[model samples]
Target: MPTALTAPAAGAVPPDASPDVTGSDAALRRYLHGLPGVDAVGLEARAATLGTRSIKTSAKAYALDLAISMIDLTTLEGADTPGKVRSLCAKGANPDPTDRTTPRVAAICVYPDMVPVAREALAGTGIAVASVATAFPAGRAGLEVKLADTREAVAAGADEIDMVIDRGAFLAGRYLQVYEEIRAVREACARPDGSAAHLKVIFENGELATYDNIRRASWLAMLAGAHFIKTSTGKVAVNATLPNTLLMLEAVRDFRAATGRQVGVKPAGGIRTTKDALKYLVVVNETAGEDWLTPEWFRFGASSLLNDLLMQRQKLRTGSYSGPDYVTVD
Candidate 1:
């Protein structure tokens, strides 16, 4: 069994950090700009190198199961229905019904209005209900509206809130605005019992336009109390990539080293194959160490990826491909 390390409590700050770093816009800008620049070629090279690593057959089975457990089985669509969410919830709880021993997913991600349905369906399953809020895929709403969105989800029994930052503000260098918005959303995640839903700040990395910007966004979100810094909304043209996910993993690893606060990293979007999932697991283990190997500190924001993982898992078990028909259609 993997020993779980407790991440820094939500909203906890580094003991020796300077107050001025997050105190003012000028200070935040200077701090973010001062951080080391990314070496694009080197980063891509390293990610590609890590992706090529091969695990033994026994290790591959374990990796497949771990990858399945880390998925935030999701359904975010205009056409989503109650029955669809219920089906997704059932799939999340029992990924491979034939085996009866498959692990449940980390969470069931849906829109705010679908939270109640998901919560009800996932009851007693020990799986989290994660809702995408703040005008998901685009953080274009006012703070009040965003907070209301977050609070509504929490009230609806969401265990986690995946909120998008104002990419417009972030791109314009309005660092403090983005930081304050995240803090407000974090507060809004609070329930009547006082325990707050975990907040995952999505950066939508593609629009950010540069590795440096993504790194800055990662640090900024972490500074403002993000429990997880995610890459992409999976709605954009360019979503999660090996280089981008690698960058986020490096950010979380360094953040923990500096603040004793272990933040999680979620790579959402285009990852869909068993091979792709295994590559990410390698990157996480190699870049962030084994402390982040569990579902508590890492997750794959994917839907179709689950089916592929299941098929591959069955193949490993029986020495023959089960084909697409072996898994349920997503």
Candidate 2:
């Protein structure tokens, strides 16, 4: 069995955190393992620190969630409006209609059903087609169902698959159940040429409050062959949070330290501003370093975030902040 490394205490301050961690690594670890509230990671402090940074550059890249309504076909219909997506992509993926073009976003996420639409719409462009499969939002189905879902999506030409873990099974302590599902999904993603769709496993951290559980979930998912371990599905109330992300990054750090795997990290859901996006980037920087900066390792699954980043980028290029309606979002 693998022994747990000595990390900062639960709800305790990180060594670099403003508030000093209170005890020996072992005690802190135990405290963290048992609780659902704050661990050595000070969420408020981290959020504030990230907020203070000046994000006045066009250097940052983003990934847009065009098809987020997994269960609602009605919403999915307009999720990635080809005209809007084309327009957005043309304008450096700027969500604000008023801004000029710079460069396009790294990828455009959508439902597997809409892959053809996004592919045709974004053809001759660098933007990729990311599909959400395996009964997302509420993955309550069986492996066969999920496998068939995954296989069909990949066959339809999906470059990536963002799968949601079965919350009911995971919450029931069935780690292997969750692990096997991801493994099967990945296998289904592999094409005859041996190439595979990028596999991003959603941990939905807002639902799991304990740092240990988050870390455990990350490791298990990575071990089961997840290319990226994401934060949330954006369907839950308590979506992505800094502390939860910090914990996941620590796992990524540890995983890399032990096995040299360069897994990705994504913080999705409710990140409505450029500031939040920057803070997430800062956390990724602090935890996983510079390697995870690109679209390959990092993606923000947001509908409203791109516009804010665009607006901020525009303000830097131009001279003033745009209005609430300044950005055109459909």
Candidate 3:
């Protein structure tokens, strides 16, 4: 998604009124923690007060939010990304494209190297160029090197920089160190003109896999100055689950309540169908409320998922699938 649109903001009305689904909170709470295949029990008691206003205003919503923050969602899907980019582009995939007939995502997230390609492809289009830099996918490099990569990507025209945090440092309980690293990277995102590209810190939540871990990570990331806190790299087992998502949403809410700063949340990875997409939408709706409904605050990092969403949308409007191998490339 475009950082300009979804980056965390500290100012919102924090409406004092409640949503219309006054009595649904309890029911919603029951449903959230009782989800199949995963345990929502620990979170069930915490998952309370959900509704349109609540979801729009929900500090604790029901479903998980999809962080399709990738512009090049599948530019590197298989092993041959360049080839895939060319092939998909040939198949009508917008190297940089958007439209009402097509599936428009939050941003054209791509690798730093592909930023220029995406830039040329999306030039003049409203979609922003989001690149994964700062030693993305594994953020294992040195700080200077990471900062340089960030500079290069931004200089190359990336509107957003999706950097992965040092999982080792985080897991080791070196929060201050992790916080400083993220803070430094965020600074690099700031241009000489004082404007800055948005920064999304990938928690790679699959590895953390605990509500407490997710909560702790959320707090650190937001405090470290992340525009958005992401779930995974879309390359892990526990990518985006309802339970983990609940924790993150609560983290965002608690953070807001504690700091008066409204940080954004992005549940990336493993989302591949409209049904799942809708579920994520439900999560965002119930948790963050309509306030976070826009692309800025919400995103789904998916490649196959877009096809499903487009197919479902087509089906909903016309009552028929777009057929197999259907993807809104163009």
Candidate 4:
């Protein structure tokens, strides 16, 4: 069984760490650049090896259900309507209407304007409502706009906020600016009741252009009080890949070891099948241990991925494949 993490506050720095690490731009830069470099060849090889490991029938059943529960069913299109959000919410609440035994998804992710719709539709369902803020796919807006976006979502009953970091600032070596932006956005996720919404910081790793940059971005976001460090916004040409997701699993594992604070990881975009999702789950188990095997610590930010999981699940139960119509069209 998967266990919950009882750790310090999200913003709490490591007890034994130096204050200088996040004290200034130069310190943060030195710390980030000082970290060990990623071996591209070795990372790809290891991910490939893990992807080849097969699971038995019983374990496969458990994994399919787990994967279903870990999904963040999403719809972030410009033409998204309230009806669409509600339909997506219904699908998330009961992935396969024919099988009440099917697990509910972790969350329903949508644009800020659709938060109320999702929240109302998922009421009493225990499914989280996650809104993409901070200018979403492109973090190009000013800080004030970003904060307002976050506050609006929280005010409208969003349980989580997915914020995008300014990749331009990050690449320009303005590390502290990016850090402070994340910190400010984290502060804006607070609800009226004093409890804050969980913050997932998106790095858009494809724009980052290097494995080392991805590592630095992961640590930088975690240090700035991110509840989850995500790989992409799912809008980039390069979304989630096995090797990059593996690298992120390693980051969360090491971060918990260093700070005694566990942060979740979400690999968004391009993950579309039960086979692909299983590969990610295998890497999570092997890299981060069984502790992160739950929906609380790991998530798949996907839309169509749910349909495939439900189809495979039906196959496992009935010993035959279900047609595409077996699942709802998202």
Worst 10-residue lDDT window, candidate 4: 1-10
Weakest 10 consecutive residues of candidate 1 by summed lDDT: 1-10
Question: Per-residue lDDT tens digits of candidate 1, residues 1-330?
Answer: 322222233334223332124556876776677667889999999999999999898688899999999999999999999999999999999999989888899999999999999999999999999999998978888999999999999999999999999999999999989988998899999988879999999999999999999988998898889999999899999999999999999888878877778999999999999999999999999999999999999999998999999999898888999899889997
The per-prediction CA RMSD against the true structure, in angstroms, equals: 5.9, 7.8, 11.0, 5.7
Task: Write model 3 residue lDDT over 1-330, tens digit each, in one string.
Answer: 211111222333122111111123233222222222223574654443221222222322122223232223545343545545544433323321323445344566777777777777665556777788778787889999999999999999889888998999777766556767888899999888889999888899878756656765776677567888888888767788766776777667755665566777777778786556665666676766777766777677766765655555555456677664555442
- Once fitted onto the true fold, the runs of candidate 2 whose alpha carbons sit more than 4 angstroms away are 1-101
Model 4 C-alpha lDDT versus the unseen true structure: 0.89
Q: Model 1 segments beyond 4 Å from truth? A: 1-21
For model 4 the local lDDT of residue 326 reads 75
Error of 3 at 131 (Å): 1.0
TM per candidate comes to: 0.94, 0.77, 0.75, 0.94
For model 3, the stretches where C-alpha displacement exceeds 4 angstroms are 1-40, 44-74, 77-83, 86-103, 326-330
Per-prediction count of colliding residue pairs? Answer: 0, 8, 26, 0
Could you tell me how far off, in angstroms, the CA of residue 282 lies in candidate 4 after the best superposition?
Answer: 0.4
